[model samples]
Target: MLSITNEGGSDMKRSFLPLFAAGLSLAVLLSGCGASSGNASQATASAAAYQEMPAATETAVDYSAGFYDAAAPAAENYDMDYGSDAAAGETAAPSGEGAAQQAADTQRKIIRHANMTLETKAFDEALREIESLVTGSGGYIESQSIDGQSLSYRGDYYERSASIMARIPAEKLDEVASQVGTLCNVVSRSESMDDISDTYFDAQARLETLNIQEERLLAILEKAESLEDVITLESALSDVRYEIESITASLRRMDSQVTYSYLNMDLREVLEYQKISDQPPAFSTRLSNAFAEGIDSIVVSLENTLLICASAGPVLVVWLVILGLLVCAILLIVRRVQRRAEQRRAARNASVQNARADQPPAVNIPPKEPEDKVK
Candidate 1:
């Protein structure tokens, strides 16, 4: 019986140990699975929460930042803000560029102006002269007016005036104005210089470009394959034509200023001299006139003589003074020459006497000796 009891207890012990081991293993496995499930749930909830937040909820983060910069390995510094500065510079550049472009466009315009006036004896003659000058200069009158005939206050005369607007070469505007002035007494004159070279060139360029565009459009219209293409070409051509017209009008105006010089004038006359009847005078008038004339002649002669003396006196005095100085100089020179001549004559006589004294006595001793020997 004891053996039986021991066997049963061993068996129970073995079974219990096995069950206990299995339970611990199962518990550990379940705990690990639960822990893993909880982590997964939390991760899922966090992801959902992140999704629920608005895009604006989080401020932008600059992820690239150096921690413990002093302890970090050396590296080249790159300024992250450079991109913003470059973008801002780019934005500012166009404003200055746009302003410069606007200034350039404004610089491309042209401008000009002129004026003149004259007075002459006849309106027709003045007009003719003005016309000829203007026409020769390649200009035409823009407008003109001639006053109707009206009796002058002095009965025999008439009053008239003319205004002519002529176009001439801009370079010759001054020349034309001066020429017009010769037709009459220049009553008034004014000249002005304005620079419209930019506008003139601008119009010319636009017109030329438009003309080219028109030619292209015409070619396109001719070669168009369909109604739609033709319509498109026609519309574009119309716009180009309008632009050309506008530019041409501007060019015409500039050309007018360049071609025509303006002249405004007034022509009139005032009688100065006229002839009168020629007749003989009476005896009393003649006698009185003769006496007055004789006295007038005598007075004029005396006055003329006095005037001549007054005008010539200073000149005469200057000449006499100059002549006196010259004579004095000549006399001084003559006196010097005479003194030199006298000195020369005295020296010549002294030299001749000295020469004769230097010579030895001749033959007298010989004659005396010969006489003594003979004795």
Candidate 2:
């Protein structure tokens, strides 16, 4: 009986131990799941708190309005002052003398633009040099349009001109401009700078905030239990992703503007460099100009007359032949009329003489009496 009781007690003890072990394991798993859920909830809450949308900007964005509009949610949603609360990934400006330098270095986002109108006697050489300069300076020609006559087209000269838009490293902008200036006569030149630091940082901060929101939304989506909850989370996730893409594109565009400087140049092919002077023309200049114009007009007239004669060869010959035939016909008609008049006068004279001869005796007596009276 003692042995049986001991066996029963040992069996019960073994069963109790197995059940306790199983319960402990289940409890640990349940606790882990609870902790994970709690941590996810806390993270989602934190992200939400960090990226609170402004009440003023709650209106729907009009994407067609373009990027310059007030619809930039990323720029508006970020709350911290840029000067005081340095953004998460960015290091704050150093405490002392280096502060100004550091601020200028990393905080400044300047876009430089230059415009120039140049005239060159040698267009091909100048164009080749400019292209070389752009390529050598690690730049690219954004756009180039040439609108003028080629040598073959014009027959006299290659008067081709080009409008070029090039992008190069900002530091090399001045150097390139200077080099180009040396290659041609600069009729006009202008330079400008734009500071977009505020805009840039705002977009960057907004992007960060949006990324946080996206990750949180993705996490919530994974654990979404109901179909409605899943749909809602997915919709939110898509919006977040879209916002991310838009902001990213804007930032990239800004980055390109900031990193590369814009060089707008108009290259004209010319035979002479235009005089660029602030002073009005002198009397001598005016007189010379007038004389030159007069000479040019005369020369142009002569050239035009020659060209007309050459071009109208067949027509001119036809007109000349018609004029000669007209003159000959007129002369021939005049000659025939004169001959008929002469013949009529002669016939009258001959008839008068015959009549005088028929009356000859009376004529002699009258002539003797008239002669005596005349003496």
Candidate 3:
């Protein structure tokens, strides 16, 4: 009984000590939380005070001193309020600026003219000569055609007429055309030039506008303040650059075309015939020529046959050694390709022989009348 009572007393003591320690820890935690809350309140108040000071200070400060310190001090000390009357003068100056602008807008027109005509005995020859002339003139033939009459024997009975379209440098148009005409007889020729000054000036103005837009876009890109703004400006700059490039390319092409002139040449070579009667071979000569051709044909045939036999001799021997085994295979494929061909022809002949062997002999009909009489 005494041991039991002592054990119970010890357990009670241990439980009471733990409850006391737990109460003390709770009290310490509450105190720290309260202190942290007070400090946070004080910091909030300090931040509010800092924010409130700026506007009050600016209002209380002397306006002139603020302004001078911020914006006007250097000008005041150095008397450096430098000014320009560009805006004022702009209204008064109606002088040469407009004329200069107009002058810049105007473009000089370059005009070129070319003409050519050629005559020859053969239209094909005339066409070839014209093509050569154009090439020699640092030009190209743009168009060409042949016409008139077909010859049965020579395969060209055509009247042999041609027209050549070509391009050459504008300054050298006349000289090139004259040189080209020397290739044949010139029947007729004409050349004309038209000035495109207005068209050129208009294109120049548009090009200038594109250039200005390009420069403006570059400036905008430099001054971009936001990511979105930068993206938008970059896209716009790309478009502007594309436009500038296209315009420049167009300008160059137009300049090149205007600097050169087009030439259209009408050429005809009459069908000149050599007298065949005068050029006829004698009978002995004809016979000799026929004999020569026959000899040539024989020689060619002999050479070809020799080459074929030489190439195929070994293959033929190897095929002969395997010929029996391959015969059925060859027959199968051959029959498949051409049913009425040689292999099928042999099979058909064999079938006819078999049918003839299987056929019975014909019998006499005298028994039919005798059977009728007995009935």
| Cα lDDT over the full model 2 | 0.64
Candidate 2 per-residue lDDT, tens place, 145-211, comes to 9998874542345577899999988878999999999999999999999997756654554454455
Give the winner by TM-score: 2
* RMSD of every prediction: 35.5, 19.8, 29.5
- What C-alpha lDDT do the candidate models reach, one value each? 0.50, 0.64, 0.52
- Please write out the lDDT profile of model 3 over residues 248-355, one tens digit for every residue: 666556566665578887776555532335378989999999999999999989987987898899999989979967898898888778965767889999999999
TM-score of 3: 0.41
lDDT tens readout by residue for model 1, 299-340: 989987987898899999999999999999999999999999
Residue 290: error of model 1 in Å? 41
Q: Lowest summed-lDDT stretch of 10 residues in model 2? A: 54-63
Compute the lDDT of residue 68 as modeled in candidate 2: 19
The most accurate candidate by lDDT is: 2
- Look at candidate 2 and tell me the lDDT of residue 221: 53
Q: What is the TM-score of each candidate against the true structure?
A: 0.37, 0.57, 0.41
Question: At residue 57, what lDDT does model 3 achieve?
Answer: 34
Point out the higher-scoring one by lDDT: 2 or 3. 2
